[model samples]
Target: MDHKALSAHQAMLGTEVSRRRLLQLAALSVAGTALTGAPAHAAPPADKHTYRLTVLGTTDTHGNVFNWDYFKDAEYTDSANNDIGLAKISTLVAAMREERGAENCLLLDAGDTIQGTPLSYYYAKIDPITGGHVHPMAAAMNAIGYDAAAMGNHEFNYGLDVLDTFDRQLNFPLLCANAVDWHTDEPVYQPYSLHTVNPEGGRKITVGVLGLVTPGVAIWDKAVVDGKVRFPGIVEQAKVFVPQMRAAGADIVIVSCHSGPNTSSSYGDALPYPENASTLLAEEVPGIDAILVGHAHLEIPQRFVTNKQTGKQVLLSEPLRWGMRLTVMDLDLVKVRGRWQVAAMGAHLLNANTVPEDPAIAAILTGDHATVRRYVNSVIGTSAAAMSAATARYEDTAAMDFVNHVQSAEVARALAGTPEAALPILSISAPFNKDATVPAGAVTVRDVAGMYIFDNTLLGIVLTGEQVRAYLEFSARYFKQVTGAGPFAPADVTNAVTDTAPNGTPDYNYDTMAGYTERLTYDIDIAHPVGARIKNLRYGDDLIDPAQRFVIAINNYRQSGGGNFPGVTTAPVVYNAQREIRQLIIDWVSEQGQIDPSSFSTTDWKLTANDVPVVIQA
Candidate 1:
């Protein structure tokens, strides 16, 4: 192929992807484009002069198969309603391979693939009939054809035993050099895997895939897996392993990580979205042609600026959580001086709607869905109406109130048989996506299946009344008070502070959201804690005092300083068991079976505009 032909093909690749994805693809050392299903054309044999490669990947798929949130069932049906699942994604992947021989394309995953939906939850929990069987996510992924994948911290939430079983059942390598087996003194994970490609002129290239999990898993999963498993730092591990993989006879290197770079709060207080160490590694480590990132669930369609270390550009991609979109990165790697370098990296969002579902994948997901319903549908409790757990108005609306109340009720009951049980209890909630509209009446299993959708478990923490106020004061981070009368200006959840260490990204400014983005702000007013914006102070039915010894109901993350919630993190954690809030909701619902919205009510948190500027509608 001549220069004109190559340039034409490269341009075609650009139009094939979104403008944002095109920018990420242009950063690649090589170039190529991809189509779905079967191909109308195929490249010539090994003797051809031109070479092409396609890289397909997805990140932050929080186990959403049916499109509807299992908890909400048919009730919740906004954009977050139904979306991507393995079947649709498999169809897309298969089509891409058909468009370009499967041999020329590499199928990979970033992380956070587990621990979001009821299926993942059911897997985390025991299979009621199977004695103790893990979920079928790994099996489905294998059936769908994932060549290699890195470890997302959510995978560790199930413990290494479950992970071991998952590793055994998988045909592809579950690579994660950073996660180690201290007991065996081994790396503990499959470090890397090789993918052979068939390009034009019948040329062949070996794509080296390396996997890395975020090191912060240590703190995030403290209750069940703190000391059992250890993780190597990402930047350090990449510095050592990337070169070794090349020596192992690989043509190109692709970094597969379950982590990504720092991002500001999309809608909550300083959520402190912990990364998997992919961004820092990209800038610090060389030889990595492209990167697949996850965790924090933000999509980077264009080239993200790496740190000052390695200045070379690296293509980065992370589609929105759930099977909402399949992030496709078409990497064109051609031989340069007898070696393969990144020719092009194109990223695009494959709408699940546009693609046909694969039968095998559909069967697996459908079976899992049935399994999920069998357990999830067992009515737990009655709600007065359909309630959601999504956070809203920078505060725990009805949903937060429900989960926190259930936890509080559970903790109170557990503590009822103990001494000093009169202490007031406080629970933690993120106020995330809480604005979900749940009409009054009967509540289904799907509505409560994954109330939080995260692996955060309930904890019983002891705290003083003074510390309690400090904790409440910490939530002031979400306040964006008004200078004058207008509307409630909420906090800037998307503020990527330039002060963050390493690379400071100022590219993302101006709130991209259109409306309902209140600019309400405020100061902590630390001198006063209780009786401030947050109320309903109590230990069971009794009121709370600044000196009372209270057993607070909280999540493991807040118990470990996650929200920087004053005394909550520093408080003594009395109990830490289970894997997800859904399990608790499941138990709560199962004990009741049929739920009405009345069973779930709003907590003490609500919006107030006293002693501040006018509510401005900017």
Candidate 2:
């Protein structure tokens, strides 16, 4: 779920009456008043069921064998370290089963089960040499058990053939409803999976699990997918399929949606940025009793979501990303007037610290520890010193530096070190990967993966030194203004308390930037657009030199036009998505023989003074 979109959505739900206004603008679906990008559906009665369905799920496990291995307690103490593995998960599963009863509890996972962590890596590449490519995830999942799961964007990382291998290895079934092969209107996936469990005496209870992945995935990973797959409109698919599931034999339809909302919205429906949630889908498709959401990795404890459009409540559980938390949702199934329905539901996260890991499950974890260590320790390449990721201290982090290096190097490699490489490569990447910060140490596979965690494709944007300054100025507003005493940020940017000084968000701390770079947070002139957010900037080392022409290399989307960032549309793109950062790193290492840490880290940021920071107050 994209929490970033929730703030704006809350403001739109109330203005639903003029929904017909959208029909005049562009594409509109008004099965019910389509609130902007929101879907339509009727409200479910509050008192419809007597029994509660307790569904617990995990997503983006990324082969997290145990809890957060990154945290070594307060002092890097191994004894104090808490591991997140199936061992701990089993405990949560057992407790939920005991508390909610097996008949009503549904355990699930949301996907990205293939890559990210060393464990998955071990199975993908390493395990093939010793044991087998058969991923241990199936065995691990079979231990704790999962009711249903959906496909995530990362599931396609190794390509469809490998994904099919993973599916064959899984103990549970894969659920996907939206992906199609284009030529064959035949479903790209199973569409939905139905489960029958006893909630009452000889009662037939069916749960239809539906899956959907982001449509942008094709753009993000165009290299392997190769336009072979088509992602159908999620809302349209639900309208067509959920009814089919209901007609088939499903009494309770649960959407194991890979889409979800970030928070509460008064908006008729939530757009949730990039992806829409089950709330929007629920309104468009009926018979869905609950939604188990994944993608965008945000955990929501209040599993019950009230639809802003229909006024009906639907059970929603999202454990965010990774195996960081476990969500348990209890659904009560009961016979109401000859029809069986969800009577009750509740959701909770297993905080790893709260309970002892089940020993049997621990043994399975212990069993795999040696193999995992061997895979991680296999050494992609040995670095003499520490290679770090981008830090809050300097915005030009190791991650950004590496990303820029990859994009620029690709341009350099493609152009083969010609005068074209002299264009002064400027790369832009999001600074928001959960694992963007890498520690200074012996570089390992996990360290590399963590630093470049985002699916963001490395992009190169061409800007003369003059226009670059304006872009810098726009990004600088995120910095904090230092009063006589200290710096301050907006409350929205920080968790800290605000005073007359202001709050502290990461963007507010422009002072953390390096010295060579002038902090753009301050506006020197009150009325001028130049030197602000890429304001009418010229293309030259010397702004007067119109003769200077440079080619920019960005991702396929930004090159074709995205981000609404101007000049980018007119900007020339010299590269495709084929050159990936990870692959580039692998190639870089392959050439270096042994990676020297010094080769990777660089002092990319330098600060400039005499510049006035922004003058915004809390």
Candidate 3:
């Protein structure tokens, strides 16, 4: 490729460029323009010199085989509606295969495929894959004809047996070079796969795909994955595999890494574990053509990393989570001395909403979909009053109260006869679903599942009053500082930062405490920055004593250093109920046979701007 062609290719690699513009440039490169108005016929015989290889990938599908949110019991159609699922992805896969001939195309996944929705939960727990039924995730991806898949962190949520079931059922290899069997010091799964494809009249091209997963699995899913398998760093694993793949005669090398791009080592240490190492892998690993990234759940269409040693830019793309986007990478390769070399490459994302859901996919998974729908829609109990999370973020609402009450009660019960029984208990929870609600009638499992979507287990951590106040202060950062004393929209109180952390705080991290009785008046002083937002922190009638110790109810995620909340992960553990929090809520509500909201406080916190009352928008 000439300098002008290289420049145009670089322009296409620019992550900030819109997909439309990238596609336009891709069209120019597809022709023999090379950034110049050159005719295609002027180039050498197309078949003899060049081969166009299209790489299509999906990441974080999370078992959304149908374009429906099982929790909502509705078709996932839009941002407002619940319609994002792999059924929509199936359409894209078929179209991409047809657009770029299936012979020259590769379909891959970056992982987090097996665990997200009620459908996945139902299959993993209810009708387990181990019990004869094929795992829905593997079945769906196999139906779509995936080339290979990496193991995501969530893949280990159900333990090695469940992961093995899904892995065994898949038609393609579930690649994870980093996850190894400690006893033998070898990968439990295949380190990589070599895919040889033959386009019409084109030379055979061998594409090497190496997969790597985040090493943080040893921390997040330590209880399950620990001692069973060891997770090594992506860069460390890549160095070993790239040479092996090269020696194995791979023409083009691609990494299916189930991790985001993070420069920092995992937990701020250089112990071979990095939460995200796609960028580092690209920079450190040589002979890599492209990388498919996931785990962050952000829409990163394309990113280019300049290798520190060779200074060659490696292409990286991360399609947004939940089957929302499909990343496409078109590699312009040329035959050189009987071997194919990548000449120019461009990648872009296609949204699921761009095409209709594949009817064939819907037809294939109808039985599983119906099973989950029937299970989730069954009425488990009733509520005396409707509970809404619409105002839960700005004010204390019954949505959180219900979760906190169940959590606190479960913790107190779990601590019976334990030394921690003497400590006062408090429960901390966050509004996971802002639009969640339960009417004053029958409450189905879906209604409760919508309120608590995550499959987090309950844990009790011992924290001091000072630490509690600090936790609240961190939670209060969710609100943007109100400079003037005036009425503001409820939604406007949120900080202007996006959810992808290392930059912005996610709403899920903003936890609400149940045992403390204090008002979090919206009186955010603009003068005070982060870590100093909460005020009038008290428990009961008197101000909280900084030294007073309390046992707080928390989910396993918070206790496992998720969300980076202070004094929570490091706090002494009083009790660890290896029970899903959602199940606890279901059991508590089912036992009561009703959800009573009258006793739940709706105003544990208030918002005021510098002593002036602020009116909340409806």
Candidate 4:
């Protein structure tokens, strides 16, 4: 049943007398209509018997077919490389299938199959999947035998046409009840699929799987799917589809949701766009035997949510990201009369790092992997001095300076003829890769790509000095308040450690403002309730006035309100090149031939307190 129907059902159950009498009367009616005057509780034929079934899932693979880091041009081997690729996951899947019995297993994915790493970008933009080249991710997933997959937000990055190509090539169904045609409100892809499986000497079981993508896709992918496709809320769509699946004779219903379990809702009740509502989905929707959660990149191996209506615990699991973990949900069902019901359910996650890479699968994608490696390793330019973003999160580094400088220069060129050209231009960038580095001798496409991981485009916006201060205030939320501190550590300055996954904001949200001469002393106490962390803010030696207007360069993600940055998305957009920032950096270095270290280098922001020395993380 859908969320609303399920809610009414729970309310009916609360009135025990009414509910019990209603069931009793229905049973009497059924018995009265029996052909052979059989009892209401008569057992069904032996063919309709109890059986065990297993559900396995993976999410946010991000197109990693091999356990290799294309950006680093090395084998992905480290604790950080836990469950790095599909090859390793293939091995685990084999072992899991053997243990669970292949006949009883149904394999699935939670979306985000493509987009991430040099390999994915190479195929999407460089090779172009429509150019008669099969995407390695699609090929690898098909080989692994995925029964069904959900729609991830990133799947729309290269546009629907590209997604359609992958969809055409896949052997499994790509389900998304929420991604629908705006006018008709009908799903653009398969909303749900019913998989009929037969265990050894057991009755045929119909397992219904429904897929839902986060409604945040409407905002994140506005450029591509705006007028053609619309994304409705997860709970809203789940409320509609679950009941249909049950009516279609499904014994067990599973939701492969590309969302997290965050308590707060971004869209709220006003719009059908809750970014993370997996918890709400399980609690509100009835007949949901299991949920495979994704998109938050969390490592929740297993969780059981108690359905308020039935008081039955429903299994939920998320396998982190990048093929790191696999969630396996084992269920036992019993046939009562003619209907099958879930008797017992359990779930857990298997780490991909524990197994070796599947050689057969690796061999299939070797040629494509080598092609990407060669492209990334091609030398682009030379750096006069060594640069590193290893400490960029805690301090200003040459690595970030390189990005800001390139962005500012290009944005200035793009805005040369615009009315905002005369205004003071500033660039804002975040340290995407803390471990990225460029040696003094030479730089390759890999070095540039390592510094900027996302496929975000550059955008220029106009903002007043007051709005700028408000922007900085919102970013200051990254820091944790420290009172009466004699000596302060990075933990004292930021809550990076305590922030849990699916709810925690990453370090990338803490933006670093560049191009302007400013000092942020981190005077958090200046405003009693925190958030006022910047002090003595200056733009080229003069204190910034609240009335002054300036043009700022930022990525399209921030311009579209990816981090909820203040005054960014709402601010008047001055320039939109729609060009990828990473590609711009690659082109800039290729043209420059040599990058001088001093061209864009400085330490602009710092943490301070009343006679307290702040120690940042390394």
Clash count for each candidate, listed in order shown: 78, 49, 9, 0
lDDT of each: 0.58, 0.52, 0.76, 0.76
Each prediction's RMSD over C-alphas, in Å, is 9.2, 12.7, 7.7, 11.8
Please give the TM-score that candidate 4 achieves against the real structure: 0.88
For residues 150-267, what per-residue lDDT tens digits would candidate 2 score against the true structure? 8876777666776777777666788777778868856777888888766443456677777776554554455556568766666677778888998888887777777555422111
The alpha-carbon lDDT assigned to residue 51 of candidate 3 equals 74
lDDT of 1 by residue, 1-618 (tens): 011222112112112444334223322312223322222123422444445566778776766555445655542255643356765566666666666576767888877666676677677666521234434566567666678877787777766676667676666788888777657545777888877775655457788999887766766676656666666677777888889988987888888887766532222233333344566677778778778777756656535444465666676777655665666666655577777765545565665554445555555456667766776555444565555533344333456566666677677777766663665565555544443444454444555644555667778878776666556554543444333333443433212233231232221111010001111112222123223543444444445466866566777765655533456555676656653565686677667655554444433434344433233231
TM-score of each: 0.77, 0.71, 0.88, 0.88
Q: How accurate is candidate 3 locally (lDDT)?
A: 0.76
Off by over 4 Å in 4: 1-48, 265-272, 484-489, 496-503, 516-529, 611-613
Error of 2 at 601 (Å): 7.2
Lowest summed lDDT over 10 consecutive residues: which window, candidate 2? 23-32
Task: Encode model 3's per-residue lDDT on 16-119: one tens digit a residue.
Answer: 43444433443342222121122221322357668777889899988888778677787675553323677677766666665566677899999998888999
